[model samples]
Target: MLETEKEKVKKDAEALQLKMYINGEWKEASDQKTRDVINPATGAVIAEAPEGTAEDAQAAIAAAKATFESGVWSDLPATERAAYLLKIADKIDEKAEELTKLETMDNGKTLREAGYDVGDAAACFRYYAGMITQPDGHTYHVADPMQAMVVREPVGVCGLIVPWNYPLLMSVWKIAPALAAGNTIVFKPSEVTPVTPTKLLEIFEEVGLPAGVANMVMGAGPVVGNEIASHKDVDMVSFTGGTKTGKHIMKTAADTMKKVSLELGGKSPNIIFADSDFETAVDYALFGIYAGAGQVCSAGSRILVEESIYEKFLARFAERAKEIRVGDGSDSKTEMGPLVSQEHLDKVLSYIEIGKEEGARLLCGGERLISDGLDKGYFVAPTAFADTTQEMRIVQEEIFGPVVAIQPFKDEEEAIRLANDSDYGLAGAVFTVDGAKGLRVIKKLRAGITWINSYHPTYNEAPWGGYKQSGIGRSLGTFGLEEFQEVKQININLEVEPIGWFEK
Candidate 1:
C-alpha cells in the first residue's frame, strides 16, 4: 500500500468509536472507557472499542430478557421472521467488500480467506432463514379421547460468544440460528477483534430487527463473558473458543442451570494410506494444516501416513510448505498472513521449541519468518515435524498454528488406532483411492465431522461439532437451529373425567 493510502486507512480506522449495541441503540461503555483495536499485520492501533464491564453486560442481558418477554420478535409469524433474516443476509452481501476489508485488517487473515468468510456468513443467514420455514414440530396418534404433541419453542435469552479466528462467520453461525428459533441474544465477540463484529449489528439495524432482539457488549471475557454465562436471565450460552475457557464457561453456566453449547479445541488427524492418490493427498495435507495459519478449531494438525508412502508424503509436504508466501494480509500475492497477535505468535514458537525438546524432527520452517521486513509483524512460516510419537506433546496437543505433526503407521488398523487416540474428537479425514476402504476408515474414526479424500470443506447443510471433550452439542444445518430451541410435549385428555384413584 502507498504511504498516503495507509495513513488514510489508519485515520479512518481511528474514527471507529466501537460503541455497544443495546435495545436497538448504539451506546458507549457504561464507564466511558475504550480500548484500541490494532491492525495485527502492522502492529498499529487502527480503531477503538468500548471497554465494557460486567455492569454493561448486565444491562444488555436485562434488555434481551425484557424484549423476549414482550414478544416483539418471538411472537412474529415464521414467514415474517424469515423475511427479516433474509433482509439481513442481503445487507451482508451488499456490504461484503467493506466487511471483508475490516476482517482482513483486524484479524490478519489473507484477503481471500477473509472474503470467503464474508460470503459464508451471508450464506449462513440465508440457510437459517429457509430453515425457519421448514417443519419444526410434530404430532402423534394416540388412543381416542386423548391427544399428544411435541412442539419447539424459543429458549428465551441466549448468550453467544465467538472466537477471533473467523470473527464475522462464527458470530453469524450462532446469531442466524438463534434469531430463526425466536430467541433473544446478548452477543460477545473477541475483544481483540471487534471491528467486523460491530458491523453485523449495523446490518441488523438496517434490516429493521426488533429492539433488544440482539445486543453486543465488547470487553475482556473474564468480565463481560462471565456475566453473560452466569446471568440468571440468560437462558443458554453458546461458546466457540479454547477448551480451557469452554470448561470455565460450562462450569460457571451450571450455577444458573443454563443450557451450554461449546465448540472447543482439536488436534485432528489427516490419515493418508498408501493407496491414496499421491498428489491430491499431498496437496490437501498442506491445505489442512496451513490454511488460516492452522488456527482453525477442526484443523487437521496431525498427519498419520501409511509407511510405504510416508517418506514421499513428507518430502512433498515440506517442499510445498516452504513455498507459501507469508506477508501483510492486504497484499493479494500473500498466500498466508501473520498470526492474529504477537502473544499467539510467541505461544506457537514456544511449541516448536517444545517439539524439538521432545525429540521430534523439525521437517521444515519451524522458526519465525523474518524476511522482507515481515519481522515487524507476527509472522511464522509453515512448520512441520516428522517422526512424532503418539505421546509427544506436539502430536497430542492442539497447537492452533501453522504446525503439523507427521507420523507413519504400519497398517490400516494402526492408522485408525492412532487417529482415534486423542482427547479431541472434533474432525478428521481419510485420503484413499479405494472408496470402500475410505468409507470403512471414515466410519471407524471417532469424530463429529469427518471426510473422505478431502479436507477443510464444510457446508451449512452439515452438522459441525465434535465428540469427547471437544464439545457438548452441534452447530449448522437443522441441528444449529434446534440448539436455541426448547422442546415441549403437550398432552390433553378429551374426556372431562379423571382417574378413579384420584376420586378415592
Candidate 2:
C-alpha cells in the first residue's frame, strides 16, 4: 500500500469512529466523558467514544417522541417507509468492510464472523422493508350484518437496547422490525461494542431517514439504558441482554405501563444420540458451544450425550478443541478469538473454578493461553468438561465462553428431562439418524426452536423466541414486526338506524 493510500485508509477508519447520535445529529455525550475502545485481540486502545449520560438518553427519547408527533415518518406511505429501509440496507452493503473491521476491532470476533453478521444485519433490514406494507388485516362477518375491520398500527416510540455479543446483528434484530411497523426508535448500543451501530448511524443519514425517526445513544446500563426503559414518552422497550438486566428493564418499563419485549439468557442444550453421525454431530456440538467465543445468547453450552457413546465422543471432542486456533481475529487461520473484555474473561474463569469445586471432570483446555508472544489480550483456551452431573455448576449455569459441559443421559425420556431441567428454553438441537426418533425428540423438547439432525440453523422468515425464561415475545419473520405494533378495529355500517330520538 502506498503512503497516500495508507493515510486514506486511516482517515476512513477515523471518520467512522463516533461519539454519539442524538436526534438527527452526531454529538458528544452531555457529560463529555469518553471511554477507550480496546482491541480485544491486542488489548490496545483503538478508539474512544463519549460515555453518554442520562441527559443524552432523555434527549433521545424526546427526539423520538417529537418525530412521532410531527407525523413525518408516521404519515409517510408504507411503501416509502419500506424504500427507506431498503436504502439503509444498501448503505450498509456499501460500508460492509468498514463495519466488519470495526466490529472485529471492538468485539474480538473474527473478520469472517463480523462480516457475516454485518450481512445478516443488512438482510434483516431488507426483509423488514418488504414487510412494512404487508401488514394487512382480516375482516369478518357479523350476525347483524354490520361491517367491521381490524387494523394494525404502530406502537409509538420504541426504545431498543442491544447486546454486545452480536452488536450489529442484535441491533438489526430490534431496529428493523420497529421501523418496519412505523415506529420511531431510540436505541442504546451496548457500551462494550458500540462501534458498529455508530457506523450504522452514519449510514442512516445517507439513506435519508427522517430526522428523529432513528437515533443512537451510547452508554452503560444504569444510565442510558434505564432511562430508555423508564422514559414515559417511550411507548415500548425491546431489550436483548442478560437475564438480570432483562428483568430490570421489564420492571422499569412496568412503571410507565410501557410495552416490553426481551431476548434474554439461555442455557440451551445440544443432544447427540448414539445413532447420530459421529463426525457431523461432533462438529455441530463444537460450533454450538464455541462459536463467537460462546457469547451467543442461544449458545448450546450444555451437551447431553447418550451414555453409550459418551466416552468415545469426549475423546474426539477434546481432540478438536485442541486444534481450534486462538489468536488475533484478523488472522484468516484463526478459528477463535479472545472474549470481549477482561471482566467477562474473569467471570468465565470463575465459572470454570466452580465447575471444579462441584466435581465435574475437566476434560481439556481449562486454563488461559499465556504465551510469551501474546500477553496483553483476554484469551482463554477453548474448554470442555466431561462426567458433568446435572447438579454441577457448569451444567446448570451459563458459562458464556468457549466452555462445554457434557452429561451422559441413559435414555430418551431422561434426555428430555435433563434438557428441560434448566430455567431457559431458547434453543436446542437433537442429532439422530432415525427420522422418527428425531421428530419425536423435537416434539418433546421444551425450547421455542429445535433443530433435528443439525444445529444453529436459523432463517429470517422463521419466528424466534423462547418457551420459558429464555424470553418473552418473538423476533424475526412477520411475527417480529408485530411486536412493535398494536391492533385497532374499525367499523362502518352501511345502513343503521338510531335506537333513540337523538339521531343526527
Per-prediction TM-score: 0.96, 0.95
Off by over 4 Å in 2: 1-17, 501-504
C-alpha lDDT (0 to 100) for residue 154 of candidate 2: 92
- The list of candidate 1 runs beyond 4 A from truth reads 1-15, 497-504
lDDT of 1 by residue, 1-504 (tens): 112223433455445767899999899888776777778788887677888889999999999999999999999999999999999989999999999899998899999999999999999999998989987688888987879999999999999999999999999999999999999999999998999999999999998899899999999999999999999999999999999999999999999999999999999999999998899999999999999989899999999999998898889999999999989889999899989888899999999999999999999998888778887788999999999999999999999999999999999899999999999999999999999999999999899999999999999999999999899899999999889999999988889886677655
lDDT for every model?
0.92, 0.87
Model 1 whole-model lDDT (C-alpha atoms):
0.92
Which residue pairs in candidate 1 have backbone atoms (N, alpha carbon, C) closer than 3 angstroms, thus clashing? none
What's the number of clashes in each of the models? 0, 0
